[model samples]
Target: MTGRHAVPEAIPQESPAPAAAPAQEAAPGFSGRLTAPLLIGSLLNPLNTTMISTALVAIGHHFGIGAADTAWLISVLYLASAVAQPVLGKLADVLGPRRVFLVGLVVVIASGLVGTVAPSFGWLLVSRLLLGIGTSAAYPAAMAVLRDESARIGRAAPRSVLARLSFAALGSAAVGPTLGGLLVMVVGWRGIFAVNVPVALVAFGAALLWIPADPPGRRAADGVAPRLGLDPLGIGLFTAALTVLVFFLLDLAHPMWWLLAPFAVLTAALVRWQLRRPDPFIDLRMLAGNAALSRTYLRHGVSYLLIYCVMYGYTQWLEEARGYSSGHTGLLMLPMSVAALVCSLLGARTKGIRGPLTLACVLLTVGAGVLMFLSGDTPLAVLLLAGACFGIPQGLIGTSNQAAVQAYAPARAIGSAAGLQRTAQYLGAITASSLIALAYGQSAGDHGLHLMAGVAAVLGVLLIVLTVTDRALRGRT
Candidate 1:
């Protein structure tokens, strides 16, 4: 699955090539000009996902809403992202990634402006929904760009290059709360929204300058008719199915089990429709045939389920049960972020995918087991150690699973595949939220933390089993 092959060499260009030149002629390696734009673009989704966490209270107070209402501020983004990622990814594949990426950034800028001046909570929801859809374009579009660059260069993307994208996402997410808090302190919750304008503008400018223009004849290259079809019915069914599923998952504490009926029906209809289309929005048949890619998505989803459980649940436990201030808890959690950053670099340097993944699962299991020993009086060192244990796996799993997706997915479908990968992660995140809500209902006490840890431990063990038994991953690096 490593993308090494002999192909025609192409000269690297810092500036845009003429429109007549083939789009794939830009570079022969993952150069700075190429990596810079992708790195900046990739930061949007994770940054937006976490940054809003710190501002929820201020937002709720300002709008005179309860926790449940404010909670939608978070859920709405996840829901929108869950639907938009693949849809935009499909558009990127069809319309050209550069175009889709730029449009997405523009949408982000507009969303930020709307959010900053939102007159009511409903407008705030609209802002978040747009933010979700806008940010959704980055990762998948970047993935498609990377794949195209790799093909142009005739080599697999170096692990380090791939890791840089992971680093951007992880680092941005790690700092989101701190950054958001500082912005809120200096300029109120509006700062969180307003800040996106300049950052996105810079990214947009860089992207415009550095990223190569799309080839003029994509449809021609594909040997298809000049007019392209986007499979709208498939997209609509997919959106409906995912929306129903996300809502059901969001309210798992008091689940609307009846929603499952519609979800199942939509999914079945989607499957039936997709199998008949030459250009389905989601290529279910490809997934059915590609067991390795299918497993990659499952592994990614389960791995994140454990990670979000720790990221969100453990922090709540620290503040509520251990009697730490939010600031102190954030400080304590710093070790996890630091460890994840360091290990991501280290993981990128390694060659074997299964080994790192196996090690990650083991560490995850050990971390969960350590959580079992925590109490109000547990030493600070022990807490830090637990955090590091979980952090190590986070870095390893993220890069490894990403590489697995790149290695396994069909070249033509890389964009949508990457988007589905993110959808898997968001689903895991939503599931983790449900799990935390169930375990820590009124408060994140010692017993609740331990109960959650037990579940996490079981999940970690399952990850280990999944990793070890997959023959497709045995010789992959």
Candidate 2:
């Protein structure tokens, strides 16, 4: 935590004239002009992730496809995002975050338009792929922008600012199903995709107006020769490895054990190739050295894994097992969303990481344990109470782990580090989906829900152990 406040390498050198001082003086803080655009941009990925949940049925019916075919619509985005997040994040670090951020929004707008006019299911898949790549850029780029702002202001970013980001992401995801359901009812499945156009447009416009321009010759200013060493070969190998790994994870119910062989080979090749490059696509050496940041990634992934399991699994159980309608299930889950929002706001006001993180882990474990007691005969009050238990941890863990990453990552590579953080979360989400499928089989039942909960409880305990044992996080804010 000693260098947690170190100025980012991308910060521009100040001019030696007194006249240039006024411009620096006029620069806005995190809550000033930067807030709206950054928050709006960061919400896109999670919003898109869950928004389609309610629209899947309509989409499958329209395309004359089964659940298996429509399943690709969901898997494709996770697959594309799992690869694109790190790639775009590295680009944000090298090419400048503002430039990358704006470009990503443009891509998002384009994807929305593509989806709106898509002629077939194949075209829709293409749209989702583009959406994944586009949305993946926002979070990492926003983190890099925050780093730049912090360096310019000569202090660490407030925990409240990070909390606002968590709020936006969590809130948008929670509302996505409701929004998608309304959109589908009003304008059909295309509305789900078409909706991105206006949102991206507004975000793009706000970003252009609010986000400061990147200083010229960033690499040169840092005393390195300007070069775009993107390492295409290394990127290819990483993508190949990740794609294979995701395919393997998605098929865990049947266990496609053979895919592991190619995944291992590609990973080995990627490691070997990256180690030799001066500007690797992913800096393995850096990750090896920064154990605290690495742990933050692990914590983030595991936390999200448990959250997604409960979110999707619990919802399905309420619908199929408890015989609740989709509308009723959404209403029942409202308590979770409300609790998460409140806890996120509360968690952000605290400066210490360990306290909230430990509480979140404890609550998550307790919530999972409570899930085992759920039955069709369970009272509505008890169901609502259970949702709130899980929601509290969702809010606390997201902000605390995010703050931990900000505290531990190297200033020079903050963008890439943020990207990898997101990649970990996506991997966790994919794993959750597989776990749900394995447990629930053809339909969500009481036994399957309890089984998933048991696994989540175990992971929750592990998260607590990891959080309490990490000495690096002891005094980190």
Using lDDT as the measure, the top candidate is 2
Q: Who wins the TM-score comparison? A: 2
Q: What pairs collide in candidate 1? A: none
**TM-scores for the candidates:** 0.85, 0.87
**Candidate 1 C-alpha RMSD relative to the actual structure:** 4.7
lDDT of 2 by residue, 106-209 (tens): 98999999999999999999999999999988987887687667656545566567667778987887676657656776788899999999999999999999
The whole-model lDDT of each prediction reads 0.77, 0.78
RMSD (Cα, Å) for all candidates, in order, is 4.7, 3.6
| Pairs that collide, model 2 | none
The 10 consecutive residues of candidate 2 with the worst lDDT sum are 1-10
Please state the error at residue 248 of candidate 1 in Å: 1.8
Q: How many residue pairs clash in each candidate?
A: 0, 0
1-477: candidate 1 lDDT, tens digit per residue:
111221111111122334565545555567898888788878988878767655655676688764345556666787788888987776776688899899999999999999999999999989989999988888878866765565455455675776688889877776665566567667888888888888889889989998878766554224452345577898789878877887787666688999999999999999999888877777777787788888999999999888877876787677567766545565676787778878877877777789999999999999999999899889999999998898888888887887787677765455566678888988787777667767776557888889889999999999999999999888776
In model 2, what is the error at residue 334, expressed in angstroms? Answer: 1.5
How many Å off is the CA of 112 in candidate 1? 2.5
